[model samples]
Structures are given as structure tokens and as C-alpha cells.
Target: MSLTSTEKCAAAEELIAGGKLEDAEFLLEQVLDSHPLNVTALNAKCGLLMRSGKMAEAKRLLQIASDIAPEDPVVLTNLANVALLENRIGDAIDSLEQAHGARPDYLAAILLLGQVHQMLGQRKEAAEWLTRASALQAEDPDVLAAGAAFELDQQNIVEARRLYEKAVETRPDHIRSLAGLARIRCLAGDFDKAVELAKKAHLLAPQDPESALVLAQVFFQSGALGDADKLIGRFKRRYADYAPIVLLGAEIRIAQGEVQQGLADVAAWFRKAPGDAARLVAFLKLLGKAGDWQRILDMCEKLPAEVRASDAVVSLQEEALLALGRTKEGWQSWARRRNLSGESPCPPVQVTLPPRAPLLDEMVLMRFVDAVARNGRLEVSGETQIPGMWERLSAAASVDWAREAAPDPQLLADLAARATLHAPENGGFRAYLAPEPGRRAMWEAALPSDGRPRVGVFWDARPPGLLIDHLQDALQDLNIHIISLQFDESRHQLRTWRGVLDAGVKLEGPGDLVNLVDCLDLVVGPDGVPLHVAGALGRRGIALLQENHEWYWAGSDRQSIWYPDVERIVLPIGPSWAGAKPALRETLERIVPALHLPVTT
Candidate 1:
């Protein structure tokens, strides 16, 4: 007994609704044979195939559905979905645009189009579409939440909070909206509000790791590590079956300086779930620190072929091997990684220098400059993108030589032409210090001729939080009458210090900060505005860098060519917690002993 086309289609729909996907596909094919242009059957089958991860089949059915009903919104939206899933971003945009044009008030089409634009990095257009979508569906909690998240990502906290608040008002239990609000509050240093929202999110979605993670971040920010520890334990217990959450917990623990315990937990989790690539990469980097090189090499050997092929992991493997002195194999691995790093856009450098190295002469430095101009690409250096060969070479040379060669006019022209600069601080040259007054009285009053050596202290800068304790320790050991040029003196700030260095030390505000920097015999601090001021004032100082040399300092050696008067104390390349802190203390100990004056005591 053969069924009619309509009957077969209805049967397929029933089968699909009943969760019998294979049966639905079979029935749908039978129906399609009798009625090849059936839009309803085609659209339904397209949706089914898409849900089942059959992208090609879904696209074909969606195309057929579109051809059958040229003006149909549903068919066009499905086509757009298929295109987006296939990563045909431009095609997805076109299809969604047409769909939106056909049905101008279609909220889903507008939202999908906006998402595609956002993913393609067209945030401006995405925002426009999102705004229109919000107007069309003003009460949509998801739309409002997405808008809030985008604004938050843009660092517009006030706008993001407003949108997030609206989303919560519309649907109070919306997890994403709650999480967005919590993140914004956390960023704004309102940990109490952040904690409240995060707790509400966790209550709403008991099994969600995201809410728990947000809570952990808030706790970490507020220095409530014990609370974070307890919440993370709850998170692990609840989501013990998942791998990423466990790895994330380990990362948080390590961040709080429980390195051994964190590493052990991470290793245990990796043994259970070896298939997760991100976690695998993270653990490999961690092992690259102090773990047995043979163990890391063994792990590399057992890595899945696909993971081994990943450039990031491959580079890590090579660098680790090189650091461990497996030079021959390491070079081979490096060759592979160099290829994986892709071709350089800049020309090749072939300049040579004499074998004898010393304080760089003008001729040697010019050869360096010519080689760079010929070969190296100009880039913006910061705490992330370390300067390239040209900038690095310049940063390592004498300031007098570099100034003569790379003058403001030539450097500015080059930077403008190339859309980059040799050094980030070259243009404008805005030194943070007010120029010292010409009058002799200001100078005489500012500089104390005390035989005790008017030692200065500045214990403030932006860093990864751990370094602050190290800074405090270094300050404590100096045992001098130190004055703080403290910037973040407010109680509400994230990086607050409560007389950690010493109770006898005087904490100065912005005005006193400047005055004290003017008066001090020797200034010392991390990379902060005061450091810059001290350098410009020709005051000898030391910079305690949190990261390695290549990170932000931009030179291979400890001495800074940028600020020749200011010596640099960098954390060593190898991962020892004792390195940066102890090195600073020793440097301080050595210098303090040389001050031929009596101790304050």
C-alpha cells in the first residue's frame, strides 16, 4: 500500500518529531521522489540534516527549498544558516541580507546576520544590525545579552551594564546575561555585585562551569583565595566528568602561586583526559618549566598526529627540546617550526659585523640599522609584541648612537611610511616628568646632601599581581627610610597595598609622589610612570621587570639602552619563582652596602 506524497511527508515529519532521524530521512527521500518541488518536505529535511551534522545534504535541501519558494523567508534563513556553518561568511551575509530584505521585521534573520558580521570582525555593521534587531524584538533577553556582551568586550562598561540590567529585567534567570553583568561588575572593581550576580547564575544553572569560573575570578580579585578554593572544589565536584573545568581550576591555583599542587592536579586530569588539545598545550608549556625534559619529550612522542602538526604545539615542543639541550633534534624541530611560522614579508638581511663585541660604535650600529631597514619588518612594541630585530638592536645600542642615526624626522617618516615604528616610545616623546625648574633653589631644595643617602622607593606598577609581593620583599630588605611614590593609593583599587613594605615608610600621593621623586638620591620600582620620570630627570634607578627580556624590555640583556641611566633587572628566561625576586634582593643588597653612609638605625 503506497502512500500519497502528502501522506509520506506527514509520516516523515512524525518520524522526525519522534526522534527517529534515519526513518525520517528514508521517508523524506521517498516523498521527494513523488514530489520533487515540495518546499515543506525539503525545508523539514534540511533542518533535520543540519541538526544531524550533515551540512552538505542540508545545503542542497535548503537550496531546493529556496528555488521552490523564491521569496520565502524560512528558506533563505536556512540557506544563510547552512552557508554560515560551512564558513562561507560572505555568502552567509548575502543570503541573510536578502532574507532580512524580504521580511524586514524578521528578528532571527537580523540577529544571525549581525552575528556573522561580528565573527568577520565588522563590529560597526554588526552593532547596527543588533540595534535594529533589538528594536524589532525589544523584549528578547538573548538579544539584549548579546548586545551587552559586545559592549563589554569593547570596554564600554556603563553601556554594557545598562543593557545587561535590561536583559535581567526581561528574563531574570538568563544565565548569559547574568554572567555578562557579573564580568562587567568584576572589571569595574565591584566584586560584591559581581559575586552576587555570579552566585545567582550558578543557582540558575547548577551544572554550568562559566558561573563558577566568574565567581573564582571575583574571589581571586578580592584576595579571597580561600573562598575561591572552596568554590573551585564545588565546581570540580559538580563537573568532575568534564576536563576543561579541571584544567581551568589548576590554572587558577597556579596563578595563586600554589604551583606544585596545581601542577599535580593538572597532571592527574591530563592522564584521565588526554584528548583535550588546549589543556594538553597548557600542560606541555607548564612541563617545559621544570619537569623532566625526557618526560616532555615522551609526551611529545605520544601526542596525536594532529596535535603534533599544530604549529603552536610544535613550536613549544621545539623550544622545550632546545632549552633541554637536545640541540640536534631541537634544530630539526625548529626547522619544521620555522617553516610553520610562515614566510616573512620583509626582505632578507645580509650585513656582517666584526666578531669582537663591545659598546656598539656608530659604524657597527649603522650597519645594524641598514640591515634592519633592508630585512626586518617594523612593528609596535609593547608588553605583548616584542620589538623585531631592528628595534631590538637599537634598544641594545648606546642611546647617543641610536639618537644620531634614528632621528625624529627620519624615524617619523619611516614609521608613517611603513605604518609602524622602530620603538613604541619614539613619537611625541612625552616624558611623564615635568621638566626640572631652571632655578637653583628648586634643585637645591629637592636634592638632599645627607650622607645617609636619601634612598627613594616606588612600589607601584601594573603586573601579574605576584610580582607585587616580590617588590614588597625587596623594599623590606633595603631597611632604609623609604618613601613610596604610590599611584594606586585608593582603597577600592585592585592592586592596593596596606603598608606591606614597612609601617615606617611614608606613602605619598600624586603631589608628594612627584616631590619625592624629585628629592630621592636613588629611585627604584617596577615599570611605572615614576620610573619614566626618574629616567628623564637623569636620576639613576633600577627597573624590576616581571617578565623575561623579550616580553616588554625588548633587549636580550639586562641593561636598557632606551634609558641608559636606568638599569634593568629582568626575570630569567627559565621558570624559577626564586629568580626575579631573589635577583632583585641581591642587587639591592649589593647597592645598599656600597652607600658609604651610616644606616638609618
Candidate 2:
């Protein structure tokens, strides 16, 4: 007569929430042993399994629970959770809708529906669903916290602060609300108040990792890297199994310039929990940051098929392949770049973009805009959010950016069809862009008549200063004239050098730059605009790829398929540029000799 099965099940749910998984399993088993088909016991056990990185097993239990009670709100909600854990986002929404239909007053399903819609960037729908939930349960702290989180994600600070304030008033001990309010204060640049609120939350629940994480993040953001590191170290000892704590600690260490240690921590976490999508994503991202693309590809091949095929992992794998010069395969997988960033709008739940097309991709839309302008007049049916972009486009071309409030289905369809940039073998036109006639004439007049080779040097974006220094040194001694086409602060480096003309000093735009590139025998460095312009014009050039080279330069070892006239010199990845000297010399010997002007290595 100690307790009924229902009471035990309820106790088990509390245990699961408290991180007492072993005790929860014991209680669930006791209830299940007495009643094998008990949905509550099954759901409770499944939650424990899922928390421990056993998604497949948890799904089996959830399926059994669902079969027994098809219309049970908890069962359907748990089913949605299982789908979410496995990255089946569409299936998750379907289950959530079913859960809400089964029990119209179920708060969890309503909040989850709102959360999922927001994750997909469907703000209007998310607001409507969250509004319904808030209207029904105004006093519930959970409901208020959910509303606050959605507002905070979109930077609606006023609304978010109000909701967080209300939630905190309802339950002062609520760690999530406290942490959220602290974040809002931090975003407002009120560091002192952020620290006070976070510290209060941490003191109330010392074991709660969310409180600790918010405090550490606040410290990190406030330029207190040392304090953040110390706090993270303290939290890591007690909350080693907590995913957010581990990730946040690693992030703090990285901010402190302890990147090697941070990478080790994330890599170790992945080794221990490869099933965790967040761990995999963190590991790959850190590896990329360290310019270790080779290691990423190696790790991907070793992982289990399920883990390898994860949306996050696959995106990184494609990036690694592209960085390592695997072009054809990378471009074949290029349409999935939208999935490269798996956005998690909510904590502990991975929300990803759908792999299908017709999403509002501004990058592709811009490309279309550019193409339309070059050809004739353009019609921009959909609205754009980029400041001053439409005005600029309208200035350049006869564009109508004043029609529909949202993107037409036709615009999305066009974006989907024209996503790929690769020129299919024997089909699409490969070279069409050319320099403006007047600008090209100006650059031609600016060139010297000394009969020496014209070399245009530009190191934009990730400027390898030392590498460019060495390259220019070798070129100056040779029978060639150097022209500095670098328009940014990097152009200052060439000021002291004598007899070097500055063509990019006051250029108007890319058109002027393209004309400068047209005058040079070679245009060099990690520049996207100049390189593509030179390639389109069938110009010969030497490309110095960056630590993380873009996908267009993929699968190119000796020469580019996109521009066979240009040769690729893949610069070594990482901070040190010393190793690239010998590689650069070899490329110079191979390509420069053909310039036919008495070149000696």
C-alpha cells in the first residue's frame, strides 16, 4: 500500500526531470512489470533512453506507447520528441499537430508547435501558435518562458523582457526565466545587472548547468575571459555529462585563446557521444576553425553511417571535401548549402532547414538579379530585407521591387532550378562576363611601355601578409612590373615599395577592378571577385587559395575545370604561412616559364 502504479509513474517522471535516470528506470520498470501496456511507464522509460543518447530504442518504446493509446496527448508529444531527436523535423510537426488535436488544452504540444515553426523561420505562424498558448495559460511560467524565448530569438527585446519579467515574477526560483532575463540584460549592455541576475539564478540552483552557462557566457561577452574560463572549469567538473555545459566551456576556453584545449574537449566529447548531433557539429566546426579540413574528412569516414548522414555532419563533410579539392562531388551536393547551418532555435532540440527548394534564398536571388540586369530589365516580385539592396538594384537595372509582400511561388521555383553554379559538361555557357570597355581602355592607357610582364597583386578577405610579402619579393626581382590592386588596408603595405603603380587606389566598383585585371598577365590572392572576373575573361593567373578555400575552386589540383587557363596554388591551412614558400616556388616554375619572358627560379 505504499503507492499506486499511477503514483509511481508520476514519481518516475519527476526523477527523469531531476537527472536521476537510474532511479527513474527502476520506478518505470516497477510500474511496467505490473502493467506491461502502461503508456505512462513506457513514455517515462523512453524519455530516459532518449536523454542517454539512445534514440532508436526510445523510438521503439514511443511506437509501442502510441499503438496502445493513439490519442494520448503525452504519447503523441513524446512521439514528436523522438522525431525531433532523430532530426525528422517534418514528422515532428505532424506529430505535434496530432498531439494538439488529441488534447486541445495540452500546453507542451502548443509550445512545441510554436517552437518548431519559429525554428523554420516561419515567424508569423509561430507568433500565432504561441499567442494561442499564452492566451490559454497566462499564469503558467512555462508558457511565459516559451513566449519570451521566441521573442528573444527574433530580437524583440521589449516583448521578450516583458515576458521574462512576468515569468520571473510568477516563479522567482525558475532558472530558465532567470537565465533568459540575464541574457536580455546582457544584450542591452547592462553587464552588471546581467551578472547579478545570473549569479542569483546560479546560487538558487548550483547544479543547474543552464544558470552556470548563462553566467559564463555573460562573463565572456563582457570581456571577462579569465572569469569565464574559471567559472566554466568549475562547472565542468560537476556537469561533465551536460551537453550545453561542455559546449559552453569549450567556447569560453576558445575565447580565451586556448583553442587547442577547446578542440580537444569537443573532439573528446564527440568520441564519447558521437550519437549526439551537437557534439558532431561542434567538433567539425572547431576543426574547420583550426584549418584542419583533412582531419574532418577523415573523421567523417570513420563515423557510423547514421552519424555520417546527419544533416549537420553531411554539411561539414561537403565543406571538407570542397576545401580538400573535391569539386565535382561537392558541387553535386552544392544544392544543400542551405542545410549547412543546422539552426537550433530551441535548446536541446536540433531544428534544421528543410532540404527541399523554394526557400527565400537571397544569395541565389541576388545572382538572379545580377543576371537579369546584365541581360535586360528585371522584375523583383518578392520583397527583400537587405537595407539599400533593392535601391541599388533599381539604380543599375529597370527593376520592380514593389509588388508582393512575400515571395511568389514562381520566384522560389526559379531559385530552386537555378541553384547550381557549375557549368554542366558540354551544355551551359562557361564564360560570359567581360570587363567594361571604357574602364579597360583606361587601364590599358595606365600601363607602362617598358615591355615587362604586368602582375596585379590583391590579397583580400584573409590576407596572408607574409605570403604576399614573399611572393612580391620574388616578383620584384624578376623582369616584371607589379600593380597593387588591393583596395583595403592591405594596400598600405605596398606604399614604401618604389616603381609600383596603384590601380585599385580609387576604383569605382568591381567593373573597374575587372578592367584592371584585364590589363595584368596574372591576378593573384584569396579574392573572389577578381578571380572570377579573370576566369570569365580567359585570363591566365596564379590563385593563392585561403586556409578555407571556397567551393568553386573545388576538385582543382593543378588547374581549374571552371577556368583551365588559371593554375591553382593551394596555400597551406593554419596560422603559419612559412610552409607555402616552397609550394609557391614550384608553381612559379611550372606556370611562370610559359609567360615567355626569361624567367629564372
Candidate 1 wrong stretches, greater than 4 Å: 1-136, 169-174, 229-247, 258-449, 460-479, 490-518, 535-538, 545-550, 554-557, 560-563, 570-582, 593-601
lDDT of 2 at 508: 69
- The whole-model C-alpha lDDT of candidate 1 against the native structure comes to 0.57
Tens-digit lDDT string for candidate 1 (1-601): 9887778778886665444667888988887777888887897788677645566777787877877797787688888777654434566778788888899998778888777777655789989999998888777887887788777766666888899899889777777788888888877667788889888876665444556777777776665666777877876764553444566576556655566777798787666656656557767766644333456678888877988888767777665554443434554565444332222224222222222212112221232233334334322221111112222232223211221222112222122112112232222122223332343245336444555565555553222333445556555544354544554532223234453323113423332344456566667776655665566445667886643221123333555644555778865332223566667666666666555524332
Summed backbone clashes in each candidate are 0, 2
TM-scores of the candidates are 0.50, 0.52
lDDT of 2 by residue, 313-423 (tens): 888887776667664455456445443322211111111111222222342234334443444554444433332323433224444454443332224323322323322
Candidate 2's C-alpha runs over 4 A off are 1-263, 287-310, 317-429, 460-474, 598-601
Evaluated at residue 80, the lDDT of candidate 1 is: 76
Name the top TM-score candidate. 2
